[model samples]
Target chain A: MNPSGLDKEIILNAAEEAIRRFGPSKTNITDIAKILKVSHAAIYRHYENKAVLLEAVTERWLSRVSRPLEPIMKENNDPEAKLRCYLKTLCQNKRSSVIEDPEMFENFAILTQNSKEALSTHVEQLFAQLEEIIRKGMETGVFETDDPREMAVTVFTATSRFHYPAFAKEWENPNIESLVNSVIDLILNGVKKRN
Target chain B: MNPSGLDKEIILNAAEEAIRRFGPSKTNITDIAKILKVSHAAIYRHYENKAVLLEAVTERWLSRVSRPLEPIMKENNDPEAKLRCYLKTLCQNKRSSVIEDPEMFENFAILTQNSKEALSTHVEQLFAQLEEIIRKGMETGVFETDDPREMAVTVFTATSRFHYPAFAKEWENPNIESLVNSVIDLILNGVKKRN
Candidate 1:
């Protein structure tokens, strides 16, 4: 609850914990309220109902991913280095989340299937950051592509083996990091301006 | 039945046709026999049962794809050009197969899920072809990679949107061909030696 007594974040945190432990299908508002030591009505004031709360939970989780990248996206670092770090950080975060809270992650994958609009927005938000980075590279003469939006999608697809959590089982492979680095090298070469 | 009458190919072709029309779940040996104009016992003599016949059908179908690529694999061409052609052909063949006969492709996908051994062998054969192409590229100092097998998987993952028929709906987009070519271009750049 962050010592604030009760706020949306507190309600969300409690809901997140409950969902993590019990799975989304079984978790209810009363359970979240029990964790918050408050009435379910209090949580309702913030999120409306179970479905809305779950949507909020997804939005919250996805925002954590986007929030950290915003600064990186706006950073003054070399475009290539920034892109490399951006992708590596995204993968590491998703991988650790999958490893530490696999049940929660699995529920999120299933939940997103029912929340396509939120999922699409989340995707667009991530792509916007990627497009920003690619556009910066083009402006600075570091990348050569004319279509930054398409290039961002290309980069996303190319790195799916690393950043996409569905392939988390493959992340346990000892060679995964090196292979990811090799793939990143290849992708970087693909986007870099040829002299 | 071929001119020789009631051979394995004839029975298998009948089975394939039956699967396509009725779908895998409803396909049966009797229907295949009906197509071949032979007694079910004649089909049974070649295949122990319906399951065995289905396995043979999958193997035969996969072989057709591999057979055509053998010469391209052995051809003395620029490694990059060979790879581009190889991947493009694979995608085109898969896309055409899906568009021309979606029912058969869907049945194959479902059937392959149950026939894991045959599916594993089919995957290995495709990976082997990919690895051979990567090895040739490395030998000619065209592509940059220390582990060709891992790189082959990476290539497969990168180009999956086009070659894997599961994404056939996405292939219907008017920009799909150019998008595929763009992705291919990115992948090619990723692999080429950085000298």
Candidate 2:
């Protein structure tokens, strides 16, 4: 197969599709190559190995979740609203991601557990989005926290039940939305400047 | 061996010791009986099967963690102090439990995952403790939450990273205490009445 017009993006999209279709455990470089109509060597030239390609696929999926939040952080001036939107979007995205293709999600969850580098990078990306909003909040005097980085982590940890994959099993619980809202209230109340 | 005087407590103690020594997968009723120097029938009389015995063992271990928190709820007059102590003790106890016997801890974690009744009962016990403190705080005007049950769940979810066994890998991070304290600060600020 011709290697012309084949790029990282094309390979990654195909890889994601392959994983989504066949699931991660059964996904192989050949499947991606076949999907891309390119030789395995072409994909190898870009990703070096199946693992690297899968990491890119995971990264791509993760970035899709973070990409929209960037504007919320950059464009929105209200820290409280920004924080709320960020958290709600994050929770919604994660829950939908799980709900859409639970089998693939579980496969990737297990895959990410074995790939700590990819896992940490994904976490750091989410943290960076939060830190940016928090830093802005502190700068604008809307929030009272001294360290936005620490506060961001605190928020992430505080809201893990809603967003974390381990707790996805409970997302179907009818009360999850109210639970998420309640926690958000508690967190917002926590970070807001004291009257 | 004679079955007289070999009560549930003795059998549970022996079962725990066997699990701690041989790990849950390998520990069996006969081993527990041998340790108790009683007939296997005696152990069987107390627990119908291995699953039941393991559940009882888990219940015993869980109770040990919760027993100390009971007085903190019932006897402590200051709700804030009680909340702080309950959280700290819970975190410390969970961390120590993991450290003391990681293998057995992992065993129990898996066991609890399979035993929904045991898991929910354990959760209810912890939530009950938090609810008591929150209710007291609300009554005394120290806390400003409308629903104490919701507040307790929020607190539990917020502090999960410190206490959840799945996050044990990150507990050794030197900054865990500071991170925990920062969260506690955020939560306290969240719950306390506005000045």
Q: Give the candidate number with the greatest TM-score.
A: 2
Clashes of 1: 0
**Which pairs clash (backbone N, Cα, C closer than 3 Å) in model 2?**
none
Q: What is the Cα-based lDDT of residue A30 in candidate 2?
A: 93
- At residue A42, what lDDT does model 2 achieve? 85
Q: Per-residue CA lDDT of candidate 2, range B44-115, in tens?
A: 888999999889888887787787777777674698888888888888888888888787778778767777
Q: Which portions of model 1 miss their true places by more than 4 Å?
A: A1-7, A10-44, A48-51, A67-77, A139-141, A165-175, B1-7, B10-44, B49-51, B64-77, B101-104, B131-150, B165-174, B193-195
Q: Across residues A1-195, which tens digit of lDDT does each residue of candidate 1 receive?
A: 333467877788888899878888899998998887777677877888899988888888877766777777767899999999888777677777787877777887767666767878988988888898888889899998878999998887777666555566667778777767777777788999877
Q: Which ten residues in a row have the lowest lDDT in candidate 1 chain B?
A: B162-171
lDDT of 2: 0.83
lDDT of 1 by residue, B1-195 (tens): 442367887788888889978988799998998888778788888899989989988887777656667788888998899888888777777777777877777787677667878877977887888888889889999998878998887777777667554466666778877777887899888788876
Candidate 2 residues A3-100, lDDT tens each? Answer: 97888888888887888788887899999999978888888888899888887777776677677777776764588898998898888888888889
Residue B26, model 1, lDDT: 90
